[model samples]
Target: MNPRRTTRSSSTAKAPHRHPRHPHNPAGRGTGRLLAAVVAATACLGVYAVPAHAAPAATGTEPVVSRGVTIPAFYNPPARLPAADGALVRTEPLTLGLRLPGLDGRPIPGTATRLMYKSTDAGGLPVAVTGAYVEPSAAWKGGGPRPLVALASGTMGQGDQCAPSLALEHPLTIGNKTLSVGYDNLAVYRFLAAGAAVVVTDYAGLGSTDRLHTYVNRVDEGHALLDAARAAHRVAGASITEGSRVGLYGYSQGGGASAAAAELQPSYAPDVNLAGTYAGAPPADLTEVMKGIDGSALAGALGWSINGFAQTDPSLRAVVDAHINATGKAALADTSTMCVGDAILGYGFTNSKKWTADGKPIADIIAAEPKLQAVLAAQRIGRLKPAAPVRLATGIQDDIVGHKQARQLAVDWCRKGADVTYKAVILPNLGDKLLTNHLAPLLTDQGSAVSWLTDRLSGKPVTSNCWTMPVQP
Candidate 1:
């Protein structure tokens, strides 16, 4: 008999959701005055309270910083995008009154610009990607020219509405719905607070009118991220120079992008002066990660990869269409329009075996096909050498992306002569395991990652631990 494959599910498991980081804001004299006014008004009419500070709308044809344009196609390049990579195709000012997630009502103080820049896809074809360039309120008083960080956000679903640029304006926006919380915004705000200029890529095709996001496609993500850094310098009023020390920060999907950028920077974007990178819980090995998450709480991620591969790779698309059953096709179609929460809720604990015509799971089917295997292999990270020092953090007991694969990335990168610091957060308690697995590390490990990037930006030397460690077995 064939060896039985094991799978886990969170369908019946009950636990408090892992809470993301929230910005710290104090309610002072202004809040007190508002409360006093509300109390005074309770005597007659019970209707009134002061509204939170709202960000004003942008005046330009292409909005600088409103949620997003009504007709996004208007922003699209009329003709073919220029052949040059990292060229700034278009830019609009993002005003200072926008709100950061977790700190709603309080406007973010910074100069933010929405960018449309040229980048390459998996096919190496020129494409336009959307991004945001932000210069913090506090000037860069650091020793050298102002440091710039190319920040990539974690998975926010594959919809155009899930774009980080739109989320920056109204923190809770996802198309027409208002979820009121965005986990990645917290990290972006943290970078800005450190007085570093930030360039955040929505990644290729994510917020664009035509292309569907090639989620986790290494070349596409890396190209979009590096180009975001290059385009940041061209944004009007953005003082980032070519000489600025650049760093990379990302977790989950973003983590993969940052890691890819680090590897591809030498040849793809040699102009970027990379100092260091911090990648937290990157799904470095998609094959392993897919198998691990098949029946887990984050099973929905598998659907995302399927949808993405189908969109980007025609050979894989043919395989998927031929193999997927009616249920699977419907499931995949439904998820195309979903945001992160909907994805998790809609597909959590669902097994792929139910979606296939044959009894085998999707992974098994993919493994049996050479074309599918090759596509996945091509998307793998750790094969290429990153130009800068990289710090990778992961919870040892992670259930979603799997700790073994994440650890393997550190080992692989080290073998490739990368200056690697692999930090594993160890917590053995059952409650801790429940809370800290997978996504929780995104929030918990971010501070250390940020600090690591900070030291690099501050011109501190990075010492490699790869030589000291024993070889991976």
Candidate 2:
């Protein structure tokens, strides 16, 4: 559906789309204190918020509303697809929704360019991807040109309104009516404040008005991220150049996207040279990750993945449609229009067994269908060695994303002779399947993540820790 609106006057924005490598605050003590403060502040903001009004529609277009938030016109894609990947389809100024006072009186994080770019999906068909590109005002003192950090956001949800570009405008509008927290702002601003340019991808079909978001589909996510880099050069005022160094950053679902982009960079976008990568809590093995999320607080994510898989693969769709009950179908349709916050509010702690026609988990359903298994197997990351040093982190207590599968990504990469540094966040169980265990480490490791990546972007080199890592079984 197309959202019709006269362009609203733009506001200053520091894009909400960057990520870093470590959480140990290896950057400095001041940064560590700031990290804690940002977390606490966002934690407070990440709550049920009062509703806000969407700008009036200018012309006639099917306005897609997710949990009461209207998708903006900038997100609407043109009918024709560009033949070239990373082609700029459209661009506009974006205003971020950060109002933190006393942080040096900075009004916004950076200059945000709301952008729609061309990208190839897993099916090899050209598709439009929406995202934001921000040029930080700080000067680059890293002994080289300003670097570009293409950030893949952790699971925002399957909804168009959940797009990171939109979240930049409504980072904490979550409530009974709607919700989204650009929790990534900490990392995005961190890098921007340090004089790095940042680009955040909305992934294929997530923000664009063409199709449903292909959640965590490796090829789609990877291509969208890499293509964002190419598109950044197309955006006006973007300082990133063809020869600029690039780094990949993400956690959770974003972790999977960054990891996939690192591996695919060699074959898909060889011109985009990589510096380093930090993949935190990447769901490398969909099978294990799926089993873990089945009955968790974010169980609705299971529906999102299934919905995306079905939309991407018709063969898998036929098999999935056969097994899904009416309730399952309804749930998938509902989640297709919801952000992570909406999903949690609506379907927390739900079980997949209830969605299936039979009294078995969807994993069992997949086991019975070879087509489904093959498609899922093809989604696995770590099959290819990444071309840069990678810092892979996972929470030992995280049952939702599964620490083992995430660690296994490092294991496989290490075996492939990739420069891999694995950090297992050893936190006490903060209640299984409650997301606390899954997300606690994100903050704990974010400082180190950013520091590690910053070092790479600054021409710093890292020795591989693969010698201490074990190969996957």
Which candidate number maximizes lDDT? 2
Worst ten-residue run, lDDT, model 2? 12-21
Off by over 4 Å in 2: 1-55, 99-108, 471-473
For candidate 1, write residues 1-473 as lDDT tens digits. Answer: 00111111222101111222112213223323432432343222112111232223224323111112232433344357766787888878764324443344323556688888898888867888998888776667665888999989887776565677755654554222211134576778787888898988989866764555678888889889998988888888777778889999988889888988899999999999899998888888898888877875456667668877776766566678788887777766555544564454456556789789896898999889998888889888899998899998877777667788888888899998899988886745332212236666776778888889988987888888776446532
Residues 151-252, model 2: lDDT tens digits = 999998877778888777666665455556678877888888888999999999877856778898999999999999889878887888787889999999
Clash totals, every prediction = 1, 18
Q: Which candidate is the best by TM-score?
A: 2
C-alpha lDDT of all candidate models, in order: 0.70, 0.79
Cα displacement (Å) at residue 181, model 2: 1.6
lDDT of 1 at 357: 85
**Least accurate 10 contiguous residues by lDDT in model 1:** 1-10
